[model samples]
Target: MIRKTMTVLALAASLGAAVGFGALPAFAQTAKATVDAGKAAGTVGEQADGFLAVVSGGDAAQRAAVVEINTGRAAVYKDTAAKTGVTAEAAGQATAKQLYARLAPGQYWKPLDGGWAKK
Candidate 1:
């Protein structure tokens, strides 16, 4: 069961990276970094707490999670991309594309959702 899940995940990530509207593992890498940064800084946790603390806040909570995950994870990829001379915008675009591809309908990374300007 575990192996199957892992395979599926790997496949999905590959698919996402491959047909990511021209983006690839590169973009996903940065997105992951951003998520890590948020987690390490506890921002992701804070956002989750703040969101859950309020009423009718499920959306908020989910949104916060996305933010935390996206920001932290993206940072990781961003740093690597930077050292390698990859443009932030390219990273951002890759992040956005991958996030969109990975997320289900009505769910997505906040920074990547309709916030193309920032990306």
Candidate 2:
């Protein structure tokens, strides 16, 4: 019984590693895919708030994807703010600048003036 239990535990551990326990959540992965699609279609753009914005209307799935990605970004901003002695909004804005600069040439971005522009 002891040997059988050890073997099972080892198998479970291996399976977990194979499946990547530390990998990003399924929602996050889905969000990335949707964001890519939205960007290509010009329906979504990166906002100055470190979240995605719908420059134009999108489908339900795209909206859900943006929600997931924005939630993750919000959490990150809050955590960084706590560590850096700044407000969450400040951290988010800082991250937005970095991410905006990394946008592809034809990608859309929402500047502080509240309109979308292609990069």
TM-score per candidate, chains pooled = 0.34, 0.76
Candidate 1 lowest-lDDT run of ten: 46-55
lDDT of 2 by residue, 61-115 (tens): 9998888777777776666656556666766666666667667888899877767
- For model 1, how does the per-residue alpha-carbon lDDT over 1-119 read when each residue is reduced to its tens digit? 45533433333343334322234366454544444344343333221111101112244444554554445445544553454455444434444444444434333233422221111
lDDT of 1 at 115: 26
* Number of the predicted model whose lDDT against the real structure is largest: 2
lDDT of model number 1: 0.38
Location of the lowest summed lDDT over 10 successive residues in candidate 2: 13-22
Deviation in Å, model 1, residue 76 alpha carbon:
2.0
lDDT of each: 0.38, 0.69
